[model samples]
Target chain A: MAKQDRAIRTRQTILEAAAVVFERQGYQAATITEILKVAGVTKGALYFHFESKEELALGVFDAQEPPEQVPPQPLKLQELVDTGLWFIHRLRTNLLTRAGVRLSMDQQAHTLDRRGPFLRWREMLLSLLDQARENGELLPHVDTSESADLIMGAFTGIQMVSQTLSDYADLEERYISMQRHVLPSLAVPSVLAALDLSPGRTERITAELAAVQD
Target chain B: MAKQDRAIRTRQTILEAAAVVFERQGYQAATITEILKVAGVTKGALYFHFESKEELALGVFDAQEPPEQVPPQPLKLQELVDTGLWFIHRLRTNLLTRAGVRLSMDQQAHTLDRRGPFLRWREMLLSLLDQARENGELLPHVDTSESADLIMGAFTGIQMVSQTLSDYADLEERYISMQRHVLPSLAVPSVLAALDLSPGRTERITAELAAVQD
Candidate 1:
C-alpha cells in the first residue's frame, strides 16, 4: 500500500511538471526531458506513466475536470455564477488548467482532442442552466442549450481577449464584465437582481475551495 | 506608371498565395517556397514584397480591414448587425479573411502581432456603437466600449465554435443565434423591433456587396 501511494504521488508530480512546461512552451515545443528535469523523476518512471508527449498532453486535458468542491446554491443562477467564478480562479492560479486551455487552443496541436474540453464545458453549463430553468431562475423563453453555448462562447472570447490584452492579469475583471452583459438576458429579474457578479467573486470562491481542501 | 502598377499586382499575388499557404499549414509550418510556387512568382518578387514570413503574416493582418461597402443605416443597431453578417459572409468565401483569423488565433505564431486584429475589430465596433449611442439606438446604460468587447468576444467565440463543430458551414446560423440572444440587451426596444436578426441576412448582405462591387 505504501509503494502504491508513492507511485501515485510520483505520477501526479510528473503531470504537474509537464503542465508547467506545456504552459510555458506549448505542446509542440515542450519536451519530455524538461518535464523529467522539473519532475526530478527518472525517465523510466516517466515513461511508465505516460507513453508519449501526446499522452501527456491528453493527461493535462483530463486534469482540467472542474474541482468537485463547488457548493450548490438554492438559486441555480448563483450556482452558475459560482461555476464561472471558480473556473476563473483556477485558471488564474493553476498551471494544469492554464496548460489545458493553452493546449486546446493551440492551432498546431493537430493530434490533441481540442474539442473535448469545449464540449465538456458546454455540457456542464447546460446541465446547470437546465436546473436554473426548472427552478424558475431563468426567463420563460430561455433555451438552455443555446444559452449554454452563448455563455461558453462569450466566456472563451473574453478570456482570449484578456490573454492577448493583459496576459490574463485582468481575467477576473473581464469575466465579470462578460457575465454582467450576458446574465441579464438569461436570468429572471429577481434572479438577476440576486446574483453576485462581482469581480472579487473569484477570490471568494478560491478561498472557499482552499478551505474545503484543507 | 506601368512599372508601379506591375509592382502592385505582384505584391497582391504574393499576399494571396501566402494567405492560401498560411490557411492550410498555419503560420509556422507555412513556407515561403510553397507561397512562391502557389503565386507562380520569382523569389526576387516575393522578397521584394515581403521580407520574411513574419512580414507576410503581418501583411495578412493588415489586409483584414473590413469591407468598406456596409451601407449606412437609419438605426445604428441594424448597421452593427450588418457588420457582423458581412464579416461572416466574407469569412465563408474569402481566403484572406479566413487566414487572418486562423493566424491571429495560432498559439505558436508568437512572432505575429496577434492583438492587432482584435484591437482593430474592437475599434470598429466601438465606433458603430458610439454612433448607436449618439442616435439613441442603444439602451441608456449600455457602455459602448464594454459592449464592443462583448460583441467582439462573442463573435470570435461563435466563429471558433462553428469552425470546430461544422467547419464554419453553420457560422451564419450560429452568428444569428448569438445576435438574437445579445442584441436584445444592447438595443432599445424600438430599434430591436426594427432590426433584421434573421439567419439569411448574411446572404442578403453578400448580394448587396457584390452588386456594389459590380
Candidate 2:
C-alpha cells in the first residue's frame, strides 16, 4: 500500500477494533491488548495510530455525525427536517444506536467539563437551528440555542427512554409524535404551518394519532 | 430498630451512599463497593438490603418527587398532569440525569434487551396519560400509551442533547417551549376553555411561559 493509503487503513483498523472492545467491555474495563487482538494489529501499530486510549476513544467518537447537519438546500424543508428526524427515528430502531450509546458512555469517563466532540455536535446543531430560525423557519420567541438543545436533547432522551421501555416498541410513531406535537414549541405557528408538511401528511397522521387517544 | 424503622434506615443508608457515588463518578463508574464504603456497610449488608444494582438504582431515582405526589390533595386534575410534566422538567435541571444515563447504559449491556428505572418511569407516565385520556383531559386523538412514550422519549433526548451542546446553558427554556407550544396539539378547543387553570399557580406560570416564546 502507498504510505498515505497504509496510514488510512491502519487508522480504520484501530477504530473498528476499538469500537468492538468498547462495546464489549466498556471504556474503563477494555484494555489495549484486547483492541489489538480485535483489530489484528500489533501494539506498535496501535501506538503509531493513537498515543493513548483516550485518543483512540476520541477517534471512535469522531465517526458519528447525525444526518441532520447535511447541507440545508436543494430539498423540500420537510426533507431537511425529516432527514434529521428520520435518522433519530432509525437511531431508536437500529443497533447502531445501541453501539453508539455504549461507546459514548465508555468514553465519557475521561471526558472533560467542556470542549470535545460532544460540544462540536452542539455547535453544528445550533448553527443549523439559527439558520432555520433567521430564515423565518422558527418562532420569533423560540430561543435558538436552547431550542436547538431541546430538539437534540429530545432525540437522545427518546432512545434512552426506549431502551428502558419494552422491546419491539415503535420508534417511528414516537418520532412522528415529537415532530407533530412536541417540536411545535420551538417553531412559530407560521413556521409550523409552513414546513414542508402537506395538509395531507399532517391530516392523515394526526387523524391516526387522534384515533389512538379516542 | 423496629421492622419498619430498620427498613427505613437501610433504605436511607443505601440511597445516601448512592447519591454520593452517583454525583461524583457518574452512574456507570460507580460500583457497589463504592456505595458500600460510603454507606459504611459490608458486602453482605449491601446485598441483603437490595437484591441488585438495578433495584438500588431505581429505588433512589426519585429525589425530586414533587409537592403533589407528597402533598395534601383534593387531587385536582391539572395538578396530576402538571406534576407528571414537572417530573420530566425537573429531570432536565436535575444533576442526577447524567449519572442516571450512564447507569442505564451499564444496565443495558448486561442483557440483549431489558427494562430500567427510566423505562418504569415511562410506564408510570403512560399510566398517568391513560388517566388523562379517560378523564377527557387530553385531546380525543392522542393515544395515551404512544403519547406517553413520545413525551418520555423527547424528554430523554433533550437532556443528552443539552449536555452535548453547552455548559451552564439555558435548559429551563426547553421546558417552557414544550409547555407553551408543543403541548397545544393534544388539547381540544373545548377542553382548553374548560381548563379552569388556577390563577395562583397555573396562571403565573402560564404568563411566564408565554413571555419566553414572545
Candidate 3:
C-alpha cells in the first residue's frame, strides 16, 4: 500500500511538471528532457506512466477537467453561470487547467486528439441548457442545442481574446461581459435578473462548496 | 516590366503554395521543401522572397485580409454582418484566408505575430459598431466596445466549432445562427427587424459587391 501510494504521487508529480513545461513551451516545443528535469523523475518512471509524449499530453488533457463538479443550483441558469464562472476561475488560478487548455488549442499538436475538451464542454452546456429550458428559464425561441454551441464558442473566443489581451487577468470581467451580452438572447427576463453572475461569484461559490464539503 | 511581372507572379505563386501547404499540414509540420515542391520554384527564388518559414507565414497572414472592403449598407449593422458574412464566405472558399485564419489561431506559432488579424478585426468591427450606435441602430444601453468584443469572440468561437464539427461545410448556417442569437442584444427592435441576416446572405452580398466594382 505504501509503495502504491508513492507510485501514484510520483505519477502526479510528473504530470504537474509536464503541464508546466507544456504551458510555457507549447506542446511541439516541449520536450521530455525538460519535463523530466522539471519533474526530477527518472526516464524509466516517466515512461512507465506514459508511453510517449502524446500519451503524456493526453494525461494532461484529462487532468484539466475539474475533479469535482460544480454543486447544482435550484435555478439551472445560475448553475449554468456557476459552471462558466468555475471554469473561468480554473483558467485564472489553475496551472493544470491552463496547460491543458493550451495543449487543446495548440495547432502544432498534431499527434494528440484535441476534440475531447470541446466536445465535453458542449455536452455539459447542452445538458444544463436543456434543464434551464425545462425549468422555464429560457426564452420561447431558445434552442438548447444552438445555445449550447453559442455559449461554448463565445466562452472559447472570449478566453482566447482575454489571454491575448491580458493573459486572462480580465477573464472574469470578460465572462461577466459575455453573460451580459449573450444571456439576454437565451434567458427570460426573470431568470436573467435572478442569476448571480457577478465578478466575485466564483470565489463565493467556491467558499460555499468548500464549506459544504467540510 | 516583363521581368518585374514575372517576379510578382512567382511571389504570388509561392505565397499561394505556402498557404496550401500550411493549411494542409499546419505551421510546424509544414516545411519549406514541401512548399517549394508545390510552388515548383528554385531554392534561390524561395529564399529571395521569404528568408524563412516564419516570414512565409507572415506573408500568408498579411494575405488573409480581404483586399476590397464590403460595399457599405444603409445600416452599419448590415455592413457589420456583411463583413462577417464575407469573411465566412472567404473561409469557406479561399485557401489563403483559411490558412491565415488557421495560423492566427495556431498556438505553436511562436515566431509569428498572430494578434494582427484579431486586432484588425476588432478595429473594423468597432468602427462599424460605433457608426451603428450613432445611427441609433443599437439599443440605448448597448456599449459598442463591449458589443464589439462579444461579436468578435462569438464569431471566432462559432467558426472554430463549425470548423471542428464540419470542416466549415456548415459555417454559413452557423454564422446565421450566431447572428440570430447575438444581434438582438445589441440592435434595436426596429433595426433587428430591418436587418438581413438570412442564410445565403453572403453569396448575395458578394455578388452585389462584385457588380458594383465592375
Model 3 iRMS: 2.0
- Can you tell me which runs of candidate 1 are displaced by over 4 Å? A28-40, B1-5, B29-34
Task: Tell me how each candidate scores on DockQ against the true complex.
Answer: 0.58, 0.39, 0.54
State the local distance difference test value for candidate 1.
0.82
Number of clashes recorded per candidate:
0, 13, 0
**Evaluated with lDDT, which candidate comes out highest?**
3
Clashing pairs in 1: none
Q: List the per-model TM-score of the A chain.
A: 0.91, 0.73, 0.93
Tell me the tens digit of each residue's lDDT in model 2 across A70-186. Answer: 333522335445555545444454444445554664424545222354455556667767677657676567676665555566655665565555442644455566667755656
Can you write out model 3's per-residue Cα lDDT over A28-86, one digit (the tens) per residue?
A: 77899999999999999999999888888988888566334788888988888888888
Write candidate 3's Cα lDDT for B1-214 as tens digits: 6999999999989999999888677677689999999999999999999999988998988866733479878999999888888888877777788888888887665566677777778888888999998998999998888888788877777777677767788777777877888888899999999999878688898898779879
Ranking by lDDT: 3, 1, 2
Q: Which CAPRI level is candidate 2?
A: acceptable
- What interface root-mean-square deviation (Å) does model 2 yield? 3.7
- Model 1, residue B103: distance off in Å is 0.8
Q: Which 10-residue span in candidate 1 chain A carries the lowest summed lDDT?
A: A104-113
- Residues A1-214 of candidate 1: C-alpha lDDT, one tens digit per residue: 6999999999889999998887667676689999999999999999999999988988888767655568778988888888878887778778888878777777666566678878888998899999988898888888899888888777777777788778888777777777777787788898888888876676777787778789
